[model samples]
Target chain A: MFRYIVRRLLQGVLTFFGATFVVYCLMFAGGGDPIQALAGEKPVTAQQRAALTEQFHLDDNFFARYLYFLKDFFTGNLKSYTGRDVFENVGSALQLTGKIALIAIIFTIVVGVTLGIVAALRRGGIFDTSSLILTLVVIGIPSIVLAPLAQYLFGIQWKIFPVNYTFEKPFVSLILPGLVLGTLSLATAMRLTRASFFDNLRADYVRTATSKGLTRFRVVGVHVLRNSLIPIITFLGVELGNLMGGAIITEGVFNIPGIGGQLYKAIGLDDGPTVITFVSLLVVIYIVANLVVDLLYAVLDPRIRYE
Target chain B: MNEHLLEVDNLFIEFHTRDGVSKVINGVSYHLNAGETLAVLGESGSGKSVTAQAIMGILDMPPGKITRGRILYRGRDLLTMSKEERRKVRGEEIAMVFQDALSSLNPVFTVGNQISETLRKRKGMSKADAMKRAVELMDQVKIPGAKERVKDYPHQFSGGMRQRVMIAMSLAMDPKVLIADEPTTALDVTVQAQIMDLLAELRRDLNMAMILITHDLGVVADVADRIAVMYAGRIVEHADVHALYKNPAHPYTKGLLESIPRLDAKGTELATIKGLPPNLLRPPTGCAFHPRCKYAQDICVTTTPPLLDLGGGRTSACHFAKELLDGRI
Candidate 1:
């Protein structure tokens, strides 16, 4: 298992370089003067331009510039186009994003999996039909639409929640944004869970478990749930990276200071350091999530040993 | 015993499908006595397994409704009992080993975990104690290197070994009545005999009453004390194994016997029943076997024959059962 993890990490490093290189090439492909893009109609002196150019290595070749970007990231000297410290921005934003993402994951797994199991066990009943319709409506509405609506309805009209996120009560403040951010994924996970649970409930082994005089709880909880989770785990693992990336719209509406919002502005201003740093971290998240999912598959299914 | 160990009386179960209700088990009734092995012989969809499922209280309720009859275990009607009461009787008093061992055993769990889980839950043994007993049960089923193999999952075992694991799992509860639903159906020919022998030997050693459900006559011919032949969810014939094989009183039973290939009849076209088994959905009028039975007559088409007692513990569900017995049909 240790060897497997080490091998995967090595592969992850290669993937990291490959992904960032492609994104770097695409960002550079935007072309024209980098200083002008950053200045955005502001009057710039030749002296200031020369100083900034020298500082940011605007004259360097593509490979040299890429190396410098990597060096600046590792050495913690990376800065945004606005002269703000990219590392500090990314770090603090990541922490906030992480909190929301964690809450979103919890909301998705708990509500999604529970509704799925209940709906599957009582398939074709009222609850099942309603769950089907509910998930469908939620999945149909993207976070862009839901976030603002939820903010207005629950936050302002109902007064159930604060209109803006407050760090005083992080959990309380993040709950609404988390639910909004996880809406699509939660709906998706519910549908997948329902289908998987339905199929596994009808499996032959479930019958065997029943014949063995196991209680309903053990049968569904331990036996059926173990089998049902394979597909859910796969979906959630792949969605982990998207939770943060997809947080942009949620964070924007709720005024939650997170990397998603930072990444958005950086991309708009063609801020190389901030974009590269944030996106590289997302790449890392994807790699780790995939590895964890793969490892979890082995745990769930004995037939799939790492060896 | 005052009453049989397990008795399934006038049991009727139907499948409510979109295509309409399929009358699966049409008044099927049979019983098992202490230390007796009663083999239920039938083709697919004959409701042999469904009857066993109903007895075990594990039948899929909506699709499979037991509209009539009682499954009495030790003089108590299981159907009438409370869910909690019936659950106590299922694994503790009556256990079942299903066909397709690979699918029947939970895939993700170790063989030991699956076995010990039941021991822990029903028997209420500690994990360590239950696990040790699980290893013993594995060894009892003749699985080599039981202690080491107990940690292995179902997929790790070969077809025969997997079936053995399933048998071991069922035997763990020390159930008085072990209902093996086509246990060897998924195994190879050579392994089929081994599994049947292992089951028979275990039954004798444990002195447990067994209901061996099988399609192949050759598989149960030696192990079975009596054979109950099912046709379209009803028992067409029930008799001692020797008497039924020597002279079957029902045409369906006779047809099944002829289907079995004999060594002396080599190079000749293997005898097969001319037509297919009747479909339970919209089955033929009156006698279900009329379409498939060679001795089917006018009366056979108009009236379903009751399972007539032919004395000497023999019964046949054919209109001309006596004539067939007398060799006059």
Candidate 2:
């Protein structure tokens, strides 16, 4: 088990490097000049341009420039293209992004799994049919469309929530945005849970469980649900990475300062280093989430621990 | 009659599906008494397992509806009982060990947890007590290092050990009647003998009535006192194991006995009953086995045979049962 975990750690590190490097290269080669973005609406003076170009090593070869960025990145001295510290800016964005994503994950696990089990048990019944339709609709509506509409209905019309996201009273302030951020994944989790539950329900062990005289609740809830969990957990782990990456639009609508917003702004302004840093962090989050998923599999399935 | 621990009477079960109603178990009847073993022997799809499932009250419902039946346990009709009442009878009064231990036991849980949790839930024993009982039960079933192995999952054990764990789980409740449905069917030949030995030993020690359901005639030869030979969801013959094997009154039973390979009669073409069992969805008009019977006649093609008493508590569902028993044909 120890060796297995060590191997996972090594794999995670390699994937992190491989993914981050690819993203960094893509951002560097992307069209639009960060120097021009930084200069804003002002007309460029030759002296100003030359000074800015030399300071940022505009003449350096692609490989040499990447090494310089890597040096700053490794040393924790990396700066945004606008001459701001990348870590400080990205760190604050990460905090808000983490909050919304955490809530979204919690909602998906709690509500999504419950509905999935219900729909599977009473398949073809009212709850099942409605949940099926609801999930399809939820998956259809992208965050760009859902964010503002939810804000209008619950925030402005019903006055049940704040129009914009607030850090305080997050249960109320962040709930709307959190749900908006989670809608797509929430639907996927529901469908995955439902399908998985259906598969396990008819398994021979379930009949043995019923033969054991276990109550319907215990048979379905404990025996069937425990076995059904592996797929849902896998989906949730992968979805966590996606939630962090995709929260940008929901955060944008809510005007919540998060990695999504930071990444978006960096992209629009052609700030290569900032974009690379935020996206790399998201990659790191993905690696860690997958590592955690492997560990969880060991818990849920004893057969895994032997390897 | 009331001395019988459990009984299934005229039980007719059919699967109602969109395609058609498949008659799975038609007028199957049998009973069990304490401290005895009854073997329900048949090939696959002969409704032996379905009969057991019906008695256990675990048959899948919407698809599996009992058209008519009375499962009497100690003078009470199990079929007429309320859901809760029937539940109380299951596991506590009667428990089952399914055919394939690998699939029958829950994969994610430890074998001990599966057994112990039952004691905790149904018996209301505390965790420690239930766990202690689980280990003891495992040890009782002759599983080595029961204490340590109790923490292991189903996949961790060999096929034989997994079946032992399943038997142990069923015996947890000290059920009056234990139904082992093809328990050793999935085991190795060497393992099959060992499992059968263990089951027989356990049955004797517990004085528990056991229903051993299997397709292997050899499996029930020594362990079973009474054997019910079924074909196409109906018992073609029922008798004492020794008597039935020596002199089968029904042609189907005689054919089944002949089909078993013999070392004493070597170099002879192994006898096989011609034709497959009829499809239950649209079974043959008369005796379900008539199409496959060498003795099939005009009457058999048009009429189903009812169980005819042949004295000495034996019965055979064949028109020529008397002639066959008298060896006149």
Candidate 3:
């Protein structure tokens, strides 16, 4: 198991490098002049252009710039294109996004799995049908639509919560939009849990448990639920990564001072360095989340071994 | 004689499909005595497993229903019993071990926990006591290192070992009757022999009546006291094991016996039963097996034959039982 974990960790590191390299290539090779975007659309002389190129290290070849980026990225010396320290500006935003995403994931799993089990146990009944219909409706509506609706209902109409921009009280700001972002995931998790649990209910082991004269609760709980959670866990892990990447719209709607909001501001100002830094950070988080999921696979199922 | 431990008289089961309600087990009747083994033998999809499931009270309700039946155990009709009462009688009075041992045991649980849970629930034993008894049951089934290896999950054990775990679990409650449904079909030949031997020994030690359900005639030859050959959800032939093997009165039984590959017939083509069992949804108008019977006559196609007593407690459901007895067919 230790060997398996170490091997997975190494693979994760390699995967992170591959992802970062893609982001780096896209930023550099793609036809976009960061200097012009930062400086504006005004006409400039050749000497001024050369000076801006030198300042941003664009004068060097692709390989040299890549090497420098890699060295600084590893040494914690990341700097934005506007000459601001990237680590100080972007790092804290990444941390805040991580916390919100983590909380949303936890809430989604607990509530989603509970509703799923309830629906499955009462299959074809009112509770099951209602839960299924509700999930479908929630998943059909995009977060872009749900976020404004949430803000309108909870913030503007009811006046029960703050309207926007609550960095000082992050938890208060997190509620409305976090819930808006989490709704689709909660629905997805519930659907997955229901399908997996029902599949397990039809398995022969469950029948065997029943034949042993086990109570219905024990049969469903110990035999059916544990085996069913395998697929649900896998899907939840992927959903966690998606939530981390996709919370931008929700953050923008509520104006939360997280990576998502920062990303929006950077994109509006066309700040290429800040965009690359934040997106690369997200890629790293996604890769690490997947790594943790792989590790959990071995833990949840004894049949899976690292070696 | 200890009287009948279980009696099923005129049991009828039906399945509801998109087409209509189709009868599967049509008025099948049988009974089991205490401390005796009755082997129910048939081809696949002959409603053998469904009958077993009905008796265990585990049949899926919406699709499957006991349309008409009387399943009497200890003089109480189990069909009319409350759910709780039936559940209480299921593992405590009558336990079942299913086919496909690997799939039958819960994969996530330890063998010891699965066995001990039944013991604790039915026998009212504490955890430590149940574990001790579970180990003993494991030792009885010849699972090596029962004390230490009890914590192993189902996948950790081999097919034969998993079957042994299943047997140990069934025997945990000291049930009066044990039903093993094709228990050895998933095993290799050598392991099949070992499981059959272990079952025979356990049956003798526990002195419990057993219902051994299998399609293999050779398997039940040594273990079963009485053999009931089922065809198309009906018992076509019933007799003592020696009598049935020595002289099969029904055509389906004869075909089944001749189909078994034997070393004595080296270099000779094995006898094969022609055609499959009739689809229960639209079975033949008269006898279900007439379409597949070599000696099926006009009367066999137009009218169903009743199970007739041919003296000496033997019965055969065939139009030409006399012809078979007289070697006229």
Every model's TM-score on chain B: 0.98, 0.98, 0.98
Q: For model 3, how does the per-residue alpha-carbon lDDT over A33-101 read when each residue is reduced to its tens digit?
A: 666767787876789889777876887898888788887777888777777887787767866676677
Isolated chain A TM-score, each model: 0.95, 0.93, 0.90
What would the per-residue lDDT of candidate 2 be over residues B1-329, giving only the tens digit for each residue? 34578888899999998889999999998888888999998989999998998889998898899999899999899989999898888898999999899999999999989999789998899999999999999999999999999999999999999999999999998998999999998999999999999999999999999999998888899999999989888988999999999999999889888989999989999999998888899999888988888888998999999999988989999988999988999
Which candidate has the highest lDDT of all? 1
Candidate 3 pairs with clashing backbones: none
Over 4 Å off, model 2: A166-171
Which candidate model has the greater DockQ, 1 or 3? Answer: 1
Name the lDDT of candidate 1.
0.90
lDDT of 3 by residue, B12-102 (tens): 9999988998778988888899999999999898878888899899888878989887998988999999988888888889999989988
Candidate models: Cα lDDT each: 0.90, 0.89, 0.85
* lDDT per residue (tens digit) for residues A111-228 in model 2: 8888898899998999999999999999898878899999999999999989997757655788889987777688998999999999999999999998888898899889998999
Q: Per-residue error at B256 for model 2, in Å?
A: 0.8
Error of 3 at B61 (Å): 1.4
Question: lDDT tens digits, residues B115-207, model 1?
Answer: 989889877899999999999998899999999998999999999999999999998889999999998888889999999999999999999
Q: After superposition, how far is residue B172 of candidate 2 from its true place, in Å?
A: 0.9
Measured with DockQ on alpha carbons, how good is candidate 1?
0.86
